[model samples]
Target: MTATSPTPSVVSSVSTLVRSPAPAGLVGHRRAGRSPAPLTTGRARRARRVLAARRRPADRDFRPDIEGLRALAVVAVVVYHAGLALPGGYVGVDVFLVISGFLITRQLLKSVGRGGLRALPTFYGHRVRRLLPAAVVVVLATTVAFRFVGPPLKVRDVATDALFTAFSGLNYRLAWVGTDYQHMGAAASPLQHFWSLAVEEQFYVVWPLVIAVVAVATRRRHLRLVLALLVVGVVAASGWASATLTPANAPWAYFSLHTRAWELGVGALLALAAPRLVALPRRLAGLAAWLGLAAIAVAAVRFTDATPFPGVAAWLPVGGAALVVASGCGPRVGAERLLGEPLVQCLGRVSYSWYLWHWPLLVVAPYALGHALGVGERLAVVWVSLVLAIASFTWVEQPVRLLHWPTWGWIGTGATLGGVVTACSALVMVLGPVTTGTGAAAVLASVDAPGAAAVTVAPAVAGTGPAASAATSAAEQAVARTVAAAVGTVQVPSNLTPLPQDAADSLPPTSRNGCHAGFTAVSQGDCRYGDLTAARTLVLFGDSHAEQWLPALDQLGKAQHWQVVSWTKAACPAARLTVDNPSLGRSYTECDTWRDATVARIGALHPALVVVSQSENVASSSVVPQAFSAATVATVRALRSAGAPRVAYVQDIPTPGTDLPGCVATHLDDVRPCTYDRSAAYRYPDRHAALAPALATASVPVLDPAPWLCTATRCPAVVGNVLVYRNESHLTVPFSRWLAPVLAPVLTTTGA
Candidate 1:
């Protein structure tokens, strides 16, 4: 009896793609018009054929040229990171991504054909063998090296980083931490490359599921549609996210699986559509490949560390990779040819091991040797990395993958990984709290100050508690008593010219209670005894770095008896230009607008003085030069043209350390830790000199307080038991008040 049933052609086609090796004669078959048969068929005979195809020898031999491409990528990345001439070498990662996607997918498709669409466990087992052994060895070595050579803070950081690496969450962790790969800190941790590994693993976990779903739903006919949607969706999403986010947000988008999926997807699409894509002429393919390489190079050179990244800027590398893959002549031209060289291919063959070893060596070598490496030392690090990569790839990676260990080997590997993770976790938990330091003593001391000594001070009778209080009370009582005596003693006949009651009542209500009136009574508030009734009012404006000197201004205002008004915001420097502040939810357009408004308001009041100071923390090579130039010109023109008698520009205070707060924290145990290396602090010698020229051109006098603060030895943190600065750059209130004695002279001379 013959039985007929609907056949599954789709299933048969997939089986053929997976089980059968690419034919050696297929290279010659390229010119032939005969199409390859679909892989799937719902029959016992076809299933047997699929299984038989697996035993056939691979006709298209393994290409060493691909390894050469890998070599080029890693070399470029290593050299670029080491501060060499190859700026655009970072794009090599894109090339690696494409290669990884193609190989992994090809293997998975083959598995699907033999097993009838499900073999996740076996697939993951292969991944474990291929990736885990080398990774485990590298991480273990890095942990030991870091403990000895890294700083205390960095040791703590890298330990946490190691845990993330183990779980394949390193990419997200790095994005959250705002790590800058190019211009890393002196105490930078060694495990940063784990970010890329995390991205790859995440892609692996999801990509198979996606392929499985598409295969089961569409069979073989709609495979191209699924690939197209995935590639387009991921690419568009990444591009959009990149354009909108800040530089700080770029890494999260760039490194995460959700963002980088598109690059891998392109490779997968090319594999599934290889028949059509591979039809291009050899010359055309070569040109496209070279063009891709050029685009990648351009991006690396032009992009700076501060450039907003992983947005539209990422297109150059990702697109270049797609071109190289589609061109199918990576064996012939440009980066491909360069990478295909014997030496280059050898490096490529061991690229994974090389990547794992290089970063840690570069990070730890300088510290183990007790100083940063010069050019020669850097070369030594590169050589050592290459040697280690070779050793690791040969000994650990190769042997582990080739040897088919029993279940016992799996158990042993699992236990070792678990023990390492547990030990690292315990170390971090034990050390985290020990680092906060003893701020309790400082806090207790502050609570014991004289003002806080008596929380419940009895209200003094007629203000006679102390000599200072008595003198202040006497003045208030005299004014009140005089006004009171006038009220009763002068209350005379019908109309004695309406006795100036408003003038009599000008003394505040506090005067009736025998307390000081007006600003003198409100001494705790930032106010002084000044002519509030005066026609002219002067407004002092700037950031806390500027506002710290309020005592100096109060003293000057008191002496001159001029009305001093103030409007200040902490850490908000006045700038003529606007930039987006991700924290504030809008562009900072108001700083300059406020400056103009303040000037106009002051002009309306016809003030004798308009004092402004902004101690901006500007790097030597910044846009500040242009911003400052414009601000200086505008300020000078505004003050001079507005008819104010004087406009004073206070110079910036000295920054105590290269990093202000970190420097303070690092030196908490040191008596003279504030002494920084001047060469490190001053990159632009001309910045200070340039300021003088700009200030000289201004109609206002530029007041420089550097001479008073700096000495030959260094800028001391404490002077006469007073902390010169509470933090890094701002003067403590006590210190600023103490400076009144010295600064009083400068104010007098400048005012004159």
Candidate 2:
């Protein structure tokens, strides 16, 4: 529920703590069978050779500057997430990917050289211990905190995301949902940051097996060539997929591992090439390091959410990280030296925990504090994240990880831990947002219960009989009177009842069958309802705003012996004009194509009435109103050219900028906070004035039900104990159905 928009998922990382090297012949220097040499003659030289042969360079190669780079990456990520002025701070994830690839590949390559597949268990076990503890703690803490602080609507999603993160499948989950990372909105998941961690975890699982199989089983002479080819294939394939997929499916492209493999592959390439680069003259190496850092800085400053990601544009930061790694492979120089300073290195040590701790803190801070974070509050969140990260790294991540279990023990224990988190998420979903303590059932019953005068219309008579037993218009007005009397200067009962329970269900019936075309739908599909066999048919045409009136139209059609059809798509108006989709970050051409197709279908159906309506908020904003007169006139003329009989236009309802379910849930006792001005409803001149051109040009009569929902005073959140609008723009099915009587008289009088 929290993810209204997409941001990248939180990534978990293994701590790269570089402890100070110990004295000669320390614990790691001597092998099991090796003996230390005494400071004697040829015997001492032989012992020294033995000790040198047995020693592993893994500890000695631990690069503090790499840790500093990590620190910088996480800092960019955290600051960017806090709404700080880093448009390309997300590039930090790219940096982390490169670094992880470089370090992990270096480790795996070394292991394969030394012991081939034999070192795999140790490698995997070390990995499990390195990442599991902090991940578990953060996920569990996030789950618990969200349940307590966030609205119930967000609880299930956060739990599911946490579960996905636990299994390193969050990227897949996000891809499935088509989560748009950039501009995905403010309600993004607290555990959204876990997605990157999933990628790293999966890479950790795979890279070892590939290297072990190639290095241990095959000839050492061919290792570099084999890996180079493999890395190239990964980079080429992933980069191609990223380029192809991003335009149509940004979320999938943004989150999918297949698309991101290239960034990491670039790191592996750099790691393989590091020895060559590090052997370069110190002057060139220093220049390369500085250049890499500068590239990263430029990318962070210049790139934005609009920049197509993980394709060629992403090479800036990824290449930069690789250059820095190559230049610093031997010893710190230039930029590497600056990056290796004590404070930065310390931050690098705790960067993984910082990454884990920062996102959830930022996401839930608003709900916990009951308001959006100000600049000071955002800084406070950053401070708190640092403190928690340092604490967790010092306490949970370090001590427990140092225990070093065997391969099977690690695999078993980690899976069990993941299972526990998964089960917790499942339980949260099963328990749901509407439960006993939440009091949602009681609220639902009150809202669904019969209102004053029992506002129900008699069932539609079969075979062209009179629609309703009673005068439907009279019933509608009577229900309206009952509502007004029931609310004598007090909040309406409808707003308080059935809240946050059937909240998402408030959409029209068209939504159930996907009759309402989504943004990317190329063509409108056929959808029919109500007295299907009737000779006369009524078509509802327009965008989702028009689709919201399905309940009302369905009722009117059935009672009047008319079949009903809806050719509607979300945000696709009948008007043939370009409009900006802020969510898609582009002009919506799919809607235009689908809208034209839908109008053609309406013409083919040639129903008794074609009811048209659309939300006008999508029209481009300017100093003057975008009435869209020419486009509206063209669409109406097209409808006329294709059809016969009456065409009615339904004016759009008011648009409010608040989530009504959340507002109603929070202000259940006092619903006035959720109400909007009746005058403000008609304030938008684009759609309102746009209606005039089409009406005058095509001679279409208008059905204005705005008065029935809102009085002269204000438009209440609910009417007659049945909640009205679903969110801010669309009407609730129950309230829309209740308006059948009001619409019946209009349809009857229109000679349909």
Candidate 3:
């Protein structure tokens, strides 16, 4: 979404627009009473005369066009977040960056001309007054609201995100976590929209300092030229970085100020060239403005979530915004008149507040209402957000901005510091303990829960000797005890394995040690696990689905005395199919390359048995189950051909289709609500429906673990005191470890 902290009266005072321009930073001043006198120092006069000579027939200080652009940008963001049809609507953020760059830089330039950066305190004070208070209010409100609707784990995340947002470092936090998906499998943070505001605030930190340096280093006559060169340098360098990093590192490219500075630089360049731009022919300027609007429209309509953002595609909206601003150098014309309309101007006036309020409502409303919102419901949310935005603007943003206490910037800073402290307190209270508790074995033993033993108790050997029969009976009796223990009213155990807050970090050792490759890495990278010195070798292979099974295999390997070697990569399936990588926003050729190399490597190892598992949900919609089944067959045959004496496909686990940890936390007293229907979990995209029969025909032997993890009709998120799944699909490491005994017999019978 797009957002910029606008000057207090930029659009709110539109009714006061006049032909005679006010002081540079004093346009549309209604609450502040009288406008400041125009800068009249010799240098300021010279600069004014130079600009006045190039001005068009009619020019005014109030830019209704800019205000209208803000409204358009904010509306696009709100619509996009509301799950409307605007896929490319996020470009509005790019437009906002440019606007912020232009306006803030122009103000700084005026200060430089008038008194050599002497108004720095006042400049900073105005910014702090304009942005921080509203941001802090929205962040606090979102965090408190989330505590009730969101699960404790997710609420803790929201609080932590709020803490970062309060200090204008939410962008950095998001960059570190990669949108909380690649690492945690958590829901989108309610405060995620703060990243843009953080970017803008960060820009303010550096841009003004650069202007001061330029003003100090250069003579007054040469100041503009030097600053222009610096702005161009920033644009080119940051633009290149954005394009280069987006392919492999979209989170960093999208959120980092270093990559996004160029959009603001483009605005600064426009402000620097304002005089020459105003001198353009009226007809040409009108055409340029129309073209700019079309460019923004095209980007908004054409882009999708899959687009690698803030790269080359971003130029479309950034340039469009710049052209719009350049056109505003003269009089309103063509599309400018439409942008300057009263309604649009009003939207622009409340745009910052609207942006701050919209995302959290959109994110939190679904859970609060206990259902995904339909279009009508979503539209209702948008309207409610609008009302909140207007209220916030009228009451919070405006009043704080108009308050003129001496050392107000310092007061704002202190208030921001207090907000940060408040957020930290919320974070600590919500997160509670960071412990994952005991392992599954300890938990199952102490709680007398069945765990995998509930299903592993097979029927007694019908024809076996007395000793064998007695052993079977003893096993049956042990399972009986497990059943008895599991029969009581199920409540969340005090010693829950991988406590809710620590669930996401409960990964297997392979993941912790970097054995599983990330998206960019093609090589499997030293992924050997479980008794590396054992004579016989077993290979475990595939994507994160395969990685989830590593804990079981690692435990089984030590018990059975075999070397377990794993080759896993994020989002890369074992099936030989061209798939899309959402993070990279393109075909995962790296997966193909990694698969080819891994298959070759497995062939050379000549493993006794190869175990394969992959999440079926990863394939793009274009990839039919038939094709996926065929690809699975090809992969199995290839593994055998590569000198794997035996190959077995593990039935992928039942996906709960909801955040399991969150659901568990929400229903700590009763986890039945977190259960998913058996048939649905094993349906088409699961690959088991198609691939199981296909593999059976090919004699590859698909081992279904469904019985171990599910009952006949449903799979509970928590099974016998162990949190079975970390997220919707992935197994918690503790649960994986607990399944070792049950999984060992089935895997061993495969004849490794």
| CA lDDT of each prediction against the hidden true structure | 0.54, 0.70, 0.74
Report the Cα lDDT for residue 473, model 1: 32
Please list the Cα RMSD from the true structure of every candidate, rounded to 1 decimal place.
Answer: 18.1, 8.3, 7.4
Count of clashes in candidate 3: 0
Residue 581 accuracy (lDDT) in model 3? 70
lDDT of 3 by residue, 1-752 (tens): 11233335533443333222323422221356776567769767554444443343222445778888999999988888888878989998999999888888888888754456676777777777777777777877787777767656766677778777767888999887873334645568888999998998898877777777677767566777888988889999999999998876788899999999999899989888875676665676788889999999999999998878878889899989988889778644698788967778778888998899889999998989988899988888887777677668777887887776776655567576556757564765655433332223323552223334433433322122231233233324343344344434245666776777667788878777778888778995657778888898889999988889999899888878889998998898899987877666667888999998999999999988899999888887677878899998899988888877588777687787777777667666665577777778854544456777787667765655565566556666655666777777789997787766645544565666
Task: Return whichever of 1 and 2 wins on lDDT.
Answer: 2
Candidate 3's error at 414, in angstroms?
4.8
> Alpha-carbon error at 727 in model 2, in Å?
2.5
lDDT of 2 by residue, 1-752 (tens): 12222122211221233342222322333358866455778676555443432341223456766877998899898889999878989999999999888888887777855677788877877777888889899998989888888877668768878878877999888766543211123367888888887888777778778887777556677787788899999999998998876765666778888889888898888777664554454566678888988999889888888887766788899889888877765433678668867678878888999999999999999989999999989988888887778678877887887775667898787788888898888887777654212212212222223445544432211112232232344555465554454333244453343455556666676676666666677765668887788988888888777887888788777877878888887666677787755444456788878877777777887777887777666565552343465676677788878874567667777655566666666555565676776667754655575564456445666655555666556667755465666665667777777667667755665567
Candidate 3, residue 209: CA error in Å? 1.9
Sort all candidates by lDDT, best to worst.
3, 2, 1
Best lDDT goes to which candidate?
Answer: 3
Give the residue spans of candidate 2 off by over 4 A: 1-60, 112-121, 175-186, 213-221, 427-476, 482-499, 623-626, 681-690
**Candidate 3 TM-score versus the reference:** 0.84
Number of the top-ranking candidate, with TM-score as the measure:
3
